[model samples]
Target chain A: MKFKTLVRPLLVATAAVGATAVAQPAAKPSPEGVATAAQNVIIDRALLTAFKALPSRFEDAKNPITAEKVELGRMLYFDTRLSKNQDLSCNSCHDLNTFGVDNKPTSTGHKKQLGGRNSPTVYNAGGHTTQFWDGRAANLEEQAKGPILNPVEMAMPSADHVVATIKSIPGYVTAFQKSFPGEADPVTYDNLAKAIGAFERQLVTPSRFDKFLGGDDKALTQVEKAGLKTFLDQGCQTCHYGPALGGSLQKLGLVVPYQAKDQGRFDLTKKESDRMVFRVPTLRNVAKTGPWFHDGSITELQTAVKLMAQHQLGKQLTDTDAKQILAFLDSLTGELPKGYIAKPKLPPSGPKTPKPDPT
Target chain B: MKFKTLVRPLLVATAAVGATAVAQPAAKPSPEGVATAAQNVIIDRALLTAFKALPSRFEDAKNPITAEKVELGRMLYFDTRLSKNQDLSCNSCHDLNTFGVDNKPTSTGHKKQLGGRNSPTVYNAGGHTTQFWDGRAANLEEQAKGPILNPVEMAMPSADHVVATIKSIPGYVTAFQKSFPGEADPVTYDNLAKAIGAFERQLVTPSRFDKFLGGDDKALTQVEKAGLKTFLDQGCQTCHYGPALGGSLQKLGLVVPYQAKDQGRFDLTKKESDRMVFRVPTLRNVAKTGPWFHDGSITELQTAVKLMAQHQLGKQLTDTDAKQILAFLDSLTGELPKGYIAKPKLPPSGPKTPKPDPT
Candidate 1:
């Protein structure tokens, strides 16, 4: 069946409904968009039909992501003093603006030191099975701790220091008690990471890709559909499958040697076979995060796609193929989190030389 | 008066109310918090007092910036394919995710050519009297058209091409007709610019700074308040005044000679006097847009501050002064536009190839 032909009927139906709404509004017109009696009848019938089609609330057991936790996480993420040097926070790299990743080749960390890996986007990270390039962490909780203690990242001296910092803040102490009851130390470093992890788990971005996946056939354009087909045909889906589309762990070089001289998982496992293995990063928001890869060598999406195809697939992709894939990738950008991107609150005093953590 | 002393009484009042509520709820406790009833009473009293204070709704007009023309202008500002190559959109550079600007040192344009200047944010562009680095456009409407036809920016062949492109799209045709009726060509390039301008006018980002401005003494922390004082004392407010701080036009190097080779306003006007003259961009949302300035040579806010102090003010600013100014600047970041950051619905087939304008 022709795509245009199928769309024509839907367009006609919409036009008919619009016409009826306009015509009926002339008689006994109401304020606002509230319909008149005749219009209401039609509207009610349509609403009823839609309601019937909707799945039961229990069947769709998606719990609401709380606003309080999001608010807390946002505050924690932006608090620069969380770092050992009192310079970095989660937001230093994963900015709410700029597509949730700092667009640097590699992110700067403690004392302006560059990290080895490109900062992946925090967007839709909730949907991924594991976090980070190495995939050492089982969840965002583990991932959060890795950055805080990592000498190259936030570079916090110890978890005890983090706990001490939180304990010192009266407001944070009160908040911690509220968030976690019956705990010896609710404001401990572990709890802080856990709270942040809870917030990160709620960052599931609903995009056009998800809309297409949810049976909205018309959600994507022709070029994007073509790219999807090409991606599948090229065997890119062999590893990058499921909702996250390659968040699951996989061998870095499926068909070719993993270049860049980085032993991805070997450092963690000390196993020869794990040398080139790495977590398959979710393609959910790949377009927004540039300077791709663990080393952040690739700048453009096209360059990344070409390199991935050549190195992993052992196949050359045309420019047109890369463009199509980019289009599809662009469709993955979802809405920004509501009320998350806000002006930073100024501290009570000017940049104070804090008395160093006694701990 | 000490802040703690003032708050102590309020805390005592709150505790009394909280105690009463807790006691009453013990037998048949409400699931709501102990403070809920007290909060409700306080809100009710406050509303009554406010109404008594200002009897007329007109006196207490809380209606924010709402101009139809401005809304229309914003729509045009966001629309892609305004360029001759039909590749670049307003969002290509001034993305919502990046608080407005694309956060690149300089954004790429049509045919993947690099633009000389970094894209400034449109967050509080409405507050500006003149627009752009050179202050060439008198208002946003004029600014909206400049980029559409700029060879280095969108690179649209001509205004005629833009008009024709809008006329061809059925959705645009209907929208233009509705927005501007009884016109020879409602979908003209001018109207397109006007629509975008209208939308831009509505993009007012309310922030904690506004609350402080509105006489909320406690709205800002002591540090931010001190920063504000330092900013005013440093004579930064001489040019960067009014609601849209620094929207007014000023010579770029008022206190010093032009350091950069780029001819600023001289390129636009061909007048020697106009050399290095540029619009003082609004400080609103400055935190989100990095790699700041017309040339985007500066990356950090502190660096920009230090340079501004050295050149514009002709005084070496202390590190303390720089930090305070940065704190003040951070407070200028505001809320994102409602519903503007939503993930867009892709065309059903997928991402589409660029097509020629039907008109």
Candidate 2:
């Protein structure tokens, strides 16, 4: 269920962006092909200092990786029986196929309830400073536990209900046992989160930009290379840097203040400093994961680009500048690991498997 | 999207059924160990005449099968982007991983809307005479078109919307082109249904029963063989006689009228002869798919077994008979095709892709 193309130019806002003059950049020459000597040096140095190529997998400290656990996690990821309605699994929102998102402004949840925030892409998320927009959860494993219990999300009655559901499916019983050996009762809710996190860790997608970071000068095209220079020159790299290209914390409105229904980290910590402060999202698949921003209100990459520069960088990006960066962002689109994300065949429900509860 | 896995026994109801006398099934001697000479001959002859081993694949006459087409269909099968919510796909209801069923008494649809009927197993649906509970569609291809447009199912607004959605994905353009060569426009609504139907054809599950039908007598355990005898002797074979074990149409209340909100095939054709008649469902994965009956009113297999006898055959199944028959039914559990149903990597949505409409 994981190998979906995350390219989301089909997003409604993208069309709105595409309709603008910046949709097709009309630079004098391609950014890559015409970069000045000074620009090239800045591009090379900036990439070397702030970024590293994405790795194929991210390692979790607590839950060691194993083929068995990953396989089990894959099944759980696709099993809709996890939700109270039996219609949603982890994949329902963080869909592996669509670059790990449902591509909604805010994801629709149980009973079709909409969430308050847009879903972050699961791809390459293991490298995040913290999971979720507010960073309330410390890691992917901790984040995995939240949704099943969230009234608007997967909505399992309780952790016990989830554990009991897994216990009812005999295959899951054996899978849990195999995934977590040496335990007397292996199918606990915590272990379920661990398994899903383990599977998610394998979702790291390395785009061509990673190859450039790996010192492949020819990996990106001329226009893309120029776009990279513009990206760094504009100070977008301050918070957006690293193997994931933005696994750090930053204020949502850095140089300028922004308003929204959510107060970002302020909601979690209830601290003035944390207000509007969000864990900076990875730019890895940003093109495929729009409408952009915390609220997912901006669909057009140009608009998102302009807004970010204005609110966060305090600089107005020209049409050519926005177009160039959009080209560079396009370089972040990565190849889906063919077989790794292939949907696993979930076990048949056992005689004791729980019935879906619509109520 | 959650309404599934109404497996009563694995469910708390499964415990209730498991607690029944049939749970232990105490006959003076085991039905298997002490089968009479007359029972052996009848079981052998009836199986030979009425049942054939399940075929590896069911061929379609209108939509010729191909590797390319099936591959594309597999992607479409797992793609929730096909639905209006971008949260429901063909896999949402007929999941290939769980024996091709969501296992709901009634499947949940877009916005967590509920459907009226139980989701049938897609495992061997191709072998059936018609599709759906009422035989409204003539074959799997036609049947494949229903749920996407059903307001209560995947809830795609229109077939054109579905086609446009598929068209928005750039990879689908190449895929449809490759899958249907020489076509001016390959990504049509009809072709989408055909591609999906092509994939569904490969969902055949071959169990021990198929091996037994292939003339491997030893494949049947002593108890299973006894159950087969009981299955045939009780006249359950009349409508259930096919490679699918039950593809023929049958009256819902042959012996006595059964009451339900849904009036079976009468809703589809509005013909008096078709009243109370439904296409006999395949028993292929009956054990895996629960909340039995059209309305999914029953969850326990034992009760479903008992009800079929009383309502459809006008016979009372003793605890011993139902237990022995259930043991036989267990033999029908087949191996899922390892990689055939593996979720495909859907193409990325393209620039022209339509945005999801939550409303």
**Over the stretch B1-359, how does candidate 2's per-residue lDDT look in tens digits?**
11121121111111211122121111123433334411443243312434667887999678899999999988988998888888888887887888888888889998889998888888889888667887777788889899989988888888888887888888998999999999999999899888989998988899998888776778888778777766654546545656888764555644323445576766765534345667788888788877688888776888888767654443456667787678788888898887877777778888888777778
A1-359 in candidate 1: lDDT tens per residue?
11221112111111212222212111222233211111211110100110111111111123233455445555677887678777788988988787678989789998888988788888666555567886777567677788888888888888887777766666677667766767777787776776677666656566786666656766767667656644543435444544556555554543223344666766666543345556767786788777777777766678777656644444446666666667777877777766666635623322332443322
TM-score of chain B of each: 0.76, 0.88
Instruction: Please identify model 2 stretches exceeding 4 Å from their true place.
Output: A1-359, B1-42
lDDT of 2: 0.72
Native-referenced DockQ of model 2: 0.01
Candidate 1's chain A scores what TM-score?
0.77
Report the lDDT tens digits of candidate 1 across residue range B67-183: 444444445565675766656678788887678889898989777779878888877776665678877676666788787787777887788777766666666676677678678
Query: Which has the greatest TM-score?
Result: 2
Candidate-wise lDDT, in order: 0.58, 0.72
